[model samples]
Target chain A: MFECLFEQASLLKKICEAIKELTDQACFEVSGTGISLQAMDSSHVSLVSFLLRNEHFSQFRCDRNLTLGLNLKMITKILKTAGNEDRVTLRAEDDGDHLVMVIESKTGNKISSYEVKMLDIDQQAFGVNETDYKASTKMSSEEFQRICHDLLVVGDTVSIEMTKDGITFSVSGTETSGCITCRQSGTVDDESVGTEITLQEPMNLSFALKFLNLFTKATPLSNSVSIEMSADQPLCIHYDIGDMGNIRYFLAPKIDDEEGAGAAGAPAAAPTEAAGGDDE
Target chain B: MGIKHLMQVILENAPDAVVENPVPSYFGRVIGIDASMALYQFLIAVRVEGQQLTNDKGEVTSHLMGMFTRTTKMMAAGLRPVYVFDGRPPEAKQNELARRHEVREDAKEKEAEAKEAGDQAEMERFSRRQVRVNQQHCDEAKRLLTLMGIPYIEAPGEAEAQCAALCRAGKIWATGSEDMDSLCFGSPILLRNLTFSEARKLPIREVHLDQVIAGLGLTMPQFVDFCILCGCDYCGTIKGIGEKNALKLIKRWGTIEQALEHLDKTKFPLPESFNYQQARALFQQPEVLDPARVDLRWGQPDEEGLVQFLVGEKQFAEDRVRATTARLRASKQTATQSRLEQFMGPPAIMTSCSAPPGPWPMVQGPIVLTPSPFPPLRQQAGAAAAEKGNKKARTSAKGAKGAAKATATKPAAKKR
Candidate 1:
């Protein structure tokens, strides 16, 4: 049995907020350590991994470690229905196929239990290897988040480039493609920051800005956000979740025009959306 | 202008004129002007005669007159100005610049088209009212700075940031600009009123760079975060978040990271990967060091040349120009005499300008000054002269390649 209560229901809102970026469905494995979910986003550009440590829970009980696969949309709906004073309980039923989530309050009580189904998702076995990246920057989560919001109007894909001088965030497209770029020249104040990590390799990578925009939602949890990447390697974005735990999102670089489809190792339609979404 | 008259003019020409607090001192230093937004204010304040000024060749001279007058006034105030001539903008900003360029180009094109279409009246109106700063105007400003003995630094990228850096390094006291971004770049002073009379009347306000962050209830890092949130040249800020909301959110969250986390979970609309930290670092970084240093000195004034340029060429009122020149010459004389006394002092021989002397006896005269009070000048003068002659030899001896040879012989010479 796992139960948590907050005067404000927004705490649970954040947990679901991060998951929605990675995949529509998530399988959370609850153990003595707490709840953990690891999955790649739909575009496969990034992997989202989350862990809520046992110590952060108000009340935690687990007889054995159990993996529960649940749909993100369903969980979001349940969280949306939750009232500020409602007590939320999440428990795995005796029956292996079901999980029970109950929200109770003076107004009424709502009990919802979802059937667990094993999804045959073809997981890519990508190794995480460290590389020498030219520059690393720490930004306020709010600022980073704001950039992502702006990108929604600019384009779906954003490119990040890091040189010896500084890091740049840009987007480009043809008559069919538009781009935005942000560059920081190496200056004195940035050099004095002990937290910066810079190597010798200039890196350029493109990824769907939408995922980044959603991934940055976790920024409010910490003051500093760290980004690590290499020229042809996957970019790693790490968020500090305080005592609760950390959430890491790793994104694979998109293929360039010259490299063609061979680099991606899979043939698929290029991701482009019609301009129908609300500006906000 | 009287308030009633000003209000009437504003009501009639509201679209053409804008009024705001005078530019701050730090921003003024960056734009290389003592008066913040002075040129723009001047353009708005003075009413131009409908009759156009013409050269001997009968070419329109209004633009040149306006540019030259504004640039000369800026130079006399000791502001170093770099006039940026517009070029083909980078692809990213091209859309925005092109949009503006189109408006100007369209007016020109429309006038020509109107004349072709036999609408002579429309063509005449467009020709009469058009105002612009062209490449020729930029070149003229540069030439004027060169002749006036004021330094002009050409910008490789954004002219405003380069100008701000000049002020930041104390190369200049302030920048004169109409844009508010100078505040974001941490300029120490800005001045808004630029005309000769207005500038003299209004005292320039010095903006403590750090105070902006403090006033906004943020740290230096958070301030950068706040600016990024407010929107920047490189990127646009989130919707529904203006300057006030941006500051409030940053203050509440303390840092960009915390803000992102809170935003991520909260029902409040938030953008992903906002990276406020990165954006802050970009604008808040310290200004680059200037390779060329400032050497403040006192020298003879070219009174005849200055008088000819200001009175004969520019047609300025002679008395006003003479009064300003007199003040400049007096200040220059006081500075020179003080330096001469320092040169006579013994301590001055040992110390470079980097290390200034401690408090010395104040010399009270028509002009208050500090005398060079060093006592060892006569004794050290001869040795210092000889040392100066062998300066190159001494430096070569201390070179890295010579270190091994010197160290190798030390012990052998000791044993002997």
Candidate 2:
């Protein structure tokens, strides 16, 4: 048997909403350590993995490890029905066919329960070990979301270049071209509230802008987002969910086709030095 | 034709067995369509007065019109539909075919009577009932599918059974048809209200076989017996037993043999020639094309080829054909950006092979679902074999370019 409770419904609601943008169904690996999920999108171009520690929940209990395969869309829809102030508890048996969810109003005057069938989603976890990234940038979540959203209109991809000066994001289309460069600034607070940048061995990579926009769906869950890029591994987008835990999205770089190769070189046009300040 | 009232019975008994999706919800999905059933519906529905739509040569074009519009519309909406046409009828199905032949003969007589009486509406209704999907229609559909750059499979027996087998094999996400037999044949997912969506305002209903089995409190074998008892197209049903009684009896007795022993033969007599056992066996294991041998790819719709076939050969309106072909080509440019939407909207997009493949190990589930993610990248279990061919051929540019690609790809391959 396994059960866990969130003090409030909105946190659970946001997490579900954010992850549903990545996958329709996923395995929530529940263990005594905490609840973690590791799943890639259908294309295998990007993966979303996260762990919400056991201490974060109001009440958490599990006798044995359980892999709860669930339809994230269905879970999101069910969570939408709950009042934001309501307390939500999820309970499931080891060999049972469904997950039982109980939602109670903060006043305790009303309570509703839902039973969603479990899916047999056998997902193979791609071990995503933390890397000594060539470049890591922390920026305001809203700012990153804007850059991704706006650049998509110019082209399908964004060429990101991190140099000794700063981190530059630029795109070049057949008819239009645009660029935004973010420079190192105020300490990216350990609490993860401020903008900052750290570059070691400058790197440049082209990534699908649409995926970047999708990773920003987690913006509501946190005020800031950190991007880690390495030549050998998938780029990681991290969103710390307050003090509880953090969710990271790993996107594979676009293996440059002829067009992408041109765009990757065009980013050199962005302003050099990119003086200190938030683009937002 | 499907088992009578089986859908209704499932709807009533299994509370949450089927999930209702908004029309046009599936994007980048590969669904298997029972071809003949769709064409038959088109013959019956797309009509002007009592006459079938035809070309200048007086050859019927109703099925072609339906196939072009439906397939292109599905493609434009990001659904990769693979048509499955029936081949030879099975021995057990001979009885059902004979019954249908008799019905069509009666309809032809009624249609003649209506024509003689100058009753246009009655004549149309009777004529529609007499419609049949022959080898000509099947050939035309396969030809049109080829022209549109879609894959089609020729089943050895029933299309519904073949579709169910394909779904079970994870070749497609679901078996799409108006037939409930796909459920009895054990398709993991059956999608209804798929075709003629503009007219069908109701949401698409997806029936999960596993969910139905669990909800009905019956094992798969028990479900097959229940379906046979409920009345299958392959055999005669019990005289007084219908869907309701069959469900209750199956739930009570657990098997058809046991139900026959407990049933009152005096009040509820048996059919003239009954063979529940044989019908159950047919439903349990029907012949189908081996899923592994089937190569599914959503190639960019051959635009020029499509125009030549539809406009130059078939006498389709040039402008309409051109406009629809434009829609098909447009989907190629924006055919799923290979990242986020696959998990959100649809699970897969069969390798379209235009963009460079990503650097990731083809980590597979036990059953790899086709329409299997990434439009341009060759990223599926079947495509992995195809990729292996390219890996061996070393297709990169010669000299420095080839060497660079090898060095770039080697680490990724080793990491996986």
Candidate 3:
């Protein structure tokens, strides 16, 4: 049997929101360490990895390591029943086919229980090793989310260009163009509104804006976001889930249809050589 | 692509996704209907002599005949149908509309050609394709529904979308449409083939969106994506990715983009300018306005207005129109009795009549003073058994009047 309890219901709620945006069904691996999920989305354009340590919970117990294949949407629905001030308890037998969730009111007198059938999801784990990311940027997640949303109306692809000066998110269409440039600042009046960038070399790539926007689902899990990228490699977005764990998203860059510059919205601040491919 | 492929995909992916041939329990329930689709089907199937049914002024009466009979049947079966009419078409649907127009035009040309060649079968087939539900058709249908005491709503967009919205809002029990698109529009319950003849032994399919989601082990969004992969009118699909392939890919990959990546690019080449995003958005958040504000009133049928509009203007057969109205009245009465039985208890047998005594009652000899055991008091009780019994009592009264002559001399002695 496995059981875990949370003092605040919002932690699990945030985790569900972060996972459901990427995939509908996921295999959750539970161990003495905690709960962790790593799976590439069906489309293979993005990958979402989530981890929550056992110590983070108010109470945690596990008899053996188990893999629970769950329909994220169903569990998400169950989680939705929990109020912010409510205490949530998750329970499952070692060989049980269903997961039981009990939500209690602040007074602990009223409680509601939901039992969801679990699935036998055939999972093939895809692991990633540490990579040497050429450039990394730490910015307010809300700012990053807004930039992605605004650029979505302009075009389908966003060109992310990082330099010693700053990082720019740009998109261009036939009738409109949008770009948001954030530079590292030593001091700012508002603590939350700031960007810090560290670059080894200038790197540029184009990625689908929709996927980027989806990555913002992790925003509620963290106040600030860290972005690490390398040329010709997938972009990694990291979110720290307070004491619980961290959620990371890796999005692959769009390659070689030769329409990058036009679809990326002019790339106004890019060096002249970056526009050479489109000219031919 | 049509949603037919989506159904096929569901069959292949989750063979038990749809539970077919199930009876719908529509008792005391309200069903929202796609009125335009119904009218189109009626016009196509109810044709006589391979020609559309028209009145004296050459106005189409087919919609009227079908709706009148169908609505009456629904009412008799205890299902309240609220016909929803389509308003302006969405901009995304312009291409589909244009394509339909082209097909209709071609069918018209073929119909004329077949007529010239004296091919009856070809002409009939082509003629069915030429049936169009125009503004006049919709207006006349609404009028007929109004006259039949059925409620209808003029939707601002696709009638199915509005019907789905009504279903979601709990204003109606289910949405009645021929297509599965209502499921994509997020209708909680969708009833298919509602217009089919009720005599068929096979039960109508009632689809619950949640059950479908559970059966397929997919979220609502994933199902919508699967439908798009199978192809939809709003966007193009990758070539060579048919129903089975699309379902398998989605099951394996979990999204269209991932499915595309796993697919053999050489075989299934993605289309240029493919905009699944817009399609997904449309299915996720369709442009359906709030349905609660619409006043849904089932008013009394305007008998005189119906006769004027259907008989006077449209030239429907006068006798048939009158017969329909009479039948409607009879059915309404029966329906009310059934409703009363359900809510309260079965009505008690009554020996009283509300009809006032005629002037000849005094001359007929004290028959009006004693209450008659027969219930019918007017010629309006066509089907009431009490009326038949009352007729016998009236016939026997004539004999009693003759007998009164002999008893008249002793009337002063028989006063007590």
Candidate 4:
């Protein structure tokens, strides 16, 4: 009864690719508004969620809201079958068990379909909203990916500090320490290349670089990425999927270890305490 | 058949008859088990996510598994368990047994219908409703008990009656079962919820008969008649008369005969074959082995025999069996405890402790299985008939495979 058509198969592949590192399976909430997914990793450390709004699809039809527990890997495998340009349509009956997916070639000459078995996952998906962040910054997706990737060799965690001037990415390992600071651009022709920093108060936060590196999987889908942070709160990494919707990743900030945090934050929930207990 | 709503009625009327927390009181004491009842409970419980546990021969071994692990855990916690087996049903109880058989038959049909509809919830409910402790089931338990050196007696008539008599003779401290009718047979200490794992936090509810008699303000004979008025496994009661109403009638008339004679039969029709007299006699003078001559003892468990029977034959995980034997070895300190300690050191390995709230495969029962995630596909209820039938959908199978349901004194049976 509910179905959503994505013009390109590549979007789903990228989304699944982005989330695979965070969780194996995710509950896809399909409704009249759009198809959205929110799931925490088994370790409950980081969480990833995506909302694909209705306007994004060429043809969208939904009779009722349906929650589908899908294996991300299986979806990735299914998506791999279609070419990047293929128009993929996901449909499921109201009370039916399988989520039927139909992929049609851009030329409309060839078509393929698959029925993915759904699982009865009982855990509730946590909701995230736009909170009053201490600091927010936007930069080129390539810049963000490079900064995350470049910082990896230097240290395990990158301590990020944002102020009135711009955002600073700092990493201090046992033997070496490095810092990459991006100054706010005065004016730009394109938003992708333009760097913007909005700050209520200067905030310094630390996060595991590996999780940030994983979030860069969505880099190919968008030209720009946004970073939002608050004191003792989880850092929000976002990639807006061309005005249709967005994919957001939340990583708990490193606690106790300020500059050179040894291991990955121990999957702390210090920031998630305000975000509600649902995320954990 | 367990004196429908008798436990609840007693608790409601005379709360003093019930002991709230009796767990600490059971240490180092011999508790008599209604063997058939315990087996029924075990078979219903040991399910791995709603599927029955079975051996390669297609023989269901949930009872054996439950008995072995539970008995070992009981011994580890310093409890002397005496399992009393059911021998034969008395003549007066035939009608009640037949009625139970019919109910099971009906449940079997309902289970099939539920399966056909893919209603996992209803299917699991119906499956638990169809718990049958046949002679073969009893034999399997006896084999395991023998391997573990747990002493068990074959009662002449009813296991409940024998347990009550044994308790009265001071051979056992209390009769352990979920049946409220254990009180009907005049068990001085009828302890319920012993069939489930102790880790469940279900405070063992102990019923004292003397306290009940004193609480109800009735003599022993009057109490027996009151129990019959409530209903027992021996006979049917007048329809439309529930436990509380029955209690009021018993208190008013003092006996079922007087109540039957005095009440109008139009509103509450008496059953045609209502034989309250024979039931009264059966409850008063139950056929049981003389507790004086009974040899209640805990002997050494044959380690090789247990491993051979449970692991080799029954497909139980070998390490678990060895682990349990190790615990049994560590537990002996007294004449019993020394033999226990003389055998091995401390490695308390009763998987039921870590076993998730098991067996009551209600909606979404998930327990972390140690040996394997899922056992080989379980045999169907009617295995021979349904062997070739496409495997039933277990897609919505698991959540917490633990015995969380404490079968308390609920009166759901009165509707039908």
Candidate 5:
């Protein structure tokens, strides 16, 4: 009645690390097909959308489809206490309200279990439309995470400009502005340029670096992650969830001072000109 | 008797009545004292203790000691103390913070000037008599409040005003303050003499909004007039007129305009334009103190964990902490037990058996999660095929080539 197994515990730990940045609490909606979680941080700057399909788990069993709202910090604590070689097993006892997470080490050591409360969260479905993004590119998760971390030192906000050639991550402060661009000419060794879609419309969106860093922490789960951006719209980052499913994050762009004041004096910088330029 | 002796005689005779006479039940419960201000008073009291108040190290130590004592006493009282810390003040209060800052700066300058002038006595006096509250101390107070399990609200502006709002709204029974402005701000109950004695012994003066207006011999509008004439927050008042004169003027005239008409324009002058209406609105408009809706659940206390954190980590005195914790534990047993019971319930059964172990582990089996399962992409593709039926046929040929690459890479990528 209380035994379930997973090949690796590290994957869950990585996932927890990713979402822990966005929000302190999230509801994991598990159904017959897969598990999905959609939650926005308190600031509404970022949202963590995670999906793990049924095929990912080696032996998944359930009496019914259930939703467990978990505290991110508690889950991260349990995961941190676990060894990497340990096989993850989660079990339910005492009427599905409590969770026991066990990690069995390779040396035949007794599995250590941590009992956590499954809180009843007020789940409200947010109506978010799936928009057709202007451009999409895949880059290494490590690179993305590193870029976000470095950019945070400069400022709290980052402006992401994507075009036909590649992606440009820019941050501007009162004194200085920094930009990192990956174009067709200067392609990194491990990175892949799938397809270049021309920017019929150039969009410059600002987002909080804190949320970006948190959501990108899921990068270790996949070698490469895909990013899709549309001007004046939410940026969607897709993480390939091995054979299980995919985790897609939709982040609402911050309203910068220029764009918010009715676009009157804001420069219409040709997104094509800055598409692959190193100049900030 | 001499003035000091007469003051002592009066203090002995009165001894400050601890509990005021009980009034109507409409007055709210559990008054909130501005903890930061209370801490300031406690620190001053400590400085006054044992005739030794001149040392900087002594001042800091005394403040810290007072903090612990106040925390312990508040915990033993059984009153849910909601301490409110001031955040960024509103633009209106910028002047106040700046004014205080300027005064502190001037005091520092004066101390320096006195030192340079070889006025050692004045310099020592100024150093010892410094009354400025430090941000570090305020932060420490907040840390202490958190440890003590006293719920605190970070006020966007003035702590006293927020406390007053809380009182008027019936969120709290009264505001524990020496400042009479709370009454002007329409706080239903204002408890004085809290510092002088224990809460049980202290008299809480429950001042009703209607009674205040009636007792002051003015309508709600004219009562605000009396306060403004007696010096409201927004601006300075007439120099000569005291509270008694302002009250008499307001009662006779029935309005500030009427009072102004009777005043000597040259000596008892008024500002160019008085915003008495806004002031009236602030003081007269009763705050919605929705008591029933406040989430009072303090959650389960990890007593052992708290003990380990405070005593072991922070190096707080064990016996003193143990005593305070014992009292808190006794009072909080029911809530804590219920929370613990809830947390110890049944576990979660993983739904997807065949799902790969990843971030979003899916449930095994051929299950279509979405109700309309042409799949969103398939539906869009079908619609695109229908719309660009002819032109996309050639594009589809190129798409097939891309699809071939995707198919080839999918399996190998999954292996890693």
Candidate 6:
């Protein structure tokens, strides 16, 4: 049996919104520590790993580690019906075919109970081993999202070059060419629109703008994002989803595309110590 | 490339989404209608021989006539319809619009050839294909709808998108359109063949968007991608990617990009510079007016204006207009009465049998009931009507006595 309560439905709603885009159905592993979901998109081009600490819940319990498979879209739809302030509680039994959920008003007067059928998803425990990246950047998610949105019109691929000068995102298409540069800032400021970058070595990588846009779907989960990249590995975009845990997205870079070469000059890479904002 | 047979694919794959519901079951429900689609359907269906319906002045009257009968029938059936008209179309629709234009132009040339050859069948078919809805047609349609007290709104973009937005905002119950793209637009419910004749063997169908999402087991974004793959008005489809392939690929790979990668490029080459993402964005968030600003009201029809437009200007049979208007008025009354009964429990009826002697003095013999205030007007002039009325009167008189006895015996029985 497993049960958890969220004081605010918006948190759960944000989590579901971030994952539903990547997968229709996901297996959620419920353990004593918390509930965590790890699934790769159908294409296997990207993987989304989400963790929600058990202590973050007002009430959390688990008799055994049970894997509850749920249709993320269904959860998103049900969550759409919940008011942002409604208290949400989820309960399920070991090997149960259904997951029961209750949403209540803050005052506990209005209550709605929903029972969503659970799927028989095989237990699959997987994790991405920690990687020491050649270069990483800590920047405002809003700025990153804006960069992706604006460059989307110019081309389909975005090239990121990290160096001592700062990280630069540039795109070039048949008719339009544009570049946005974010110089590393030395101080922490506003939560949104703040730019900070940490670069250990000069690294240049390219990724599909569409996938980058999809990653920004997690923008609502965090105000800041940390981008870690290695030579030819998939870029890891991490968002700290409040006190609960973090949601990380690993997106494969576009290996070879004409847009990469045609884009404005690929800035020379610069090497420097990793920014202090990176993970300890 | 509006995914050829995308609707058929949805119908086949998500059978549970489509439901055959009775027309009357939708009574009291507000339906958002695509006015342009309805007009186009009318132009195609309501033709006599190879020619279109026109007024004495040679102006097309098919739309006016079609909407008149359809709105009247819907009103009589207690279904409130609010028509939505398409405004300036998006630039992306230019290709589709041009394609349609070419089709009509080709049909026009064929129609002339058929006419010269005296091939009646070919001429009829090509002539039907050449039918088009223009500005004057739209103006007359709006004018007629206005005179009939029906509510209509001109959407800033696609009418179906506006209808879907209204459904999303809870401004309307469902959208009525022949195309299933309304599903892609995220309409909560889409009623198909709402304008088709009931005499046909096929039944009217409705698809719930929620069930569609559940049945497809795809997230809304994936569903939109699926639609784009099959084809959409906004963009071209990847060659050789039909409905079945698109569904299989989307369901298997989750997105077009992955599906494209998995597919053999030699068999299905991706279009050059295919803007599937842009098309996806268009479906994900269509431009529509704020729902709160929309005001939908059903007011009294302008009888004088209707007659002036339909009979005086459009040369409709005056008697036909009068008869339809009368029917509309009567149905409106009945609908109101039914609505009242539905809300406030059934109206209190006087039990004529009770003999408490509070309101009226006791009558020694059979008490005659005054003739009913409301009677079938035509029936009242016939002998059968009198006989029926007399029988009803006698039954009520006897009913009064019987009721009194039952009431009187209840207390005695209790005492015993």
**Candidate 5 lDDT over residue span A172-279, tens digit each:** 754577988867343434454232334556656667676678777787788777778776556778888775566777666655222213322322111112123211
DockQ, candidate 5, comes to 0.02
Predicted structure 1, TM vs. truth = 0.35
Candidate 2 has a DockQ of 0.04
Best by TM-score: 2
TM-score of 5: 0.42
Instruction: DockQ each candidate and list the results.
Output: 0.01, 0.04, 0.00, 0.02, 0.02, 0.00
Tens-place lDDT per residue, model 1, B269-321, is: 65554444544554665233241442212123345655665456555467865
Please provide, for model 4 over B1-416, each residue's C-alpha lDDT reduced to its tens digit, 9 standing for 90 to 100. Answer: 58777777788778968876546445556899989988998899889889789999999999988898888878776677888888778998788788889999999999999999999999999999898998888877777776676778788788899899989888898999888778878889988887796668787788899888888878888888888877778878778887777778878988887888889999888888888888888988989878877765455677888888889989999999999987864443321111111111111111111112222112121222222211111111112113323122121111101111111111111110
Docking class of 3: incorrect
lDDT agreement of model 3 with the native: 0.67
Q: Write the per-residue lDDT of candidate 2 for residues B1-416, one digit (tens) a residue.
A: 67778788777878577878765557656899999888988887776765888887888888888888978888776677888878778888889999999999999999999989999889888888899999778777776776676667778788899888888788898999999899999999899878763666777888988878887889999988888888888889888899889889999999998999999999999988898877887898788777766656555555677677777767889999988888775654442433333223323211111112333223334222233222111112113324333222222212212222121121111110
Q: Which of 2 and 6 is the better model by lDDT?
A: 2
Report, to 2 decimal places, the DockQ of model 6.
Answer: 0.00
**Model 1 regions more than 4 Å off:** A1-280, B1-31, B34-47, B50-96, B102-131, B195-205, B255-416
TM-score of each: 0.35, 0.64, 0.47, 0.48, 0.42, 0.49
- Using TM-score as the yardstick, the better of models 1 and 4 is 4
- What is the per-residue lDDT of model 5 for residues B308-352, given as tens digits with 9 covering 90 to 100? 645664555778667766665443321110110121121121322
lDDT of 6 by residue, B376-396 (tens): 111121223233332322122
Ranking by TM-score: 2, 6, 4, 3, 5, 1
* lDDT of predicted model 1: 0.47
lDDT of 3 by residue, A150-252 (tens): 8999977788998888899988764687888898874476667578887888888777787889899889888889899987567889898885578888777
Per-candidate alpha-carbon RMSD to the true structure:
32.6, 16.5, 35.2, 22.7, 22.9, 32.2
Question: Where does candidate 5 stray beyond 4 Å?
Answer: A1-4, A107-109, A120-125, A185-200, A258-280, B1-416
Worst lDDT run of 10 residues, candidate 5 chain B, spans B407-416
Instruction: List candidate 4 segments past 4 Å from native.
Output: A1-280, B22-24, B334-416
Q: Which residue ranges in model 2 land beyond 4 Å of their true spot?
A: A1-136, A154-223, A228-236, A240-280, B23-25, B47-52, B112-123, B199-202, B333-416
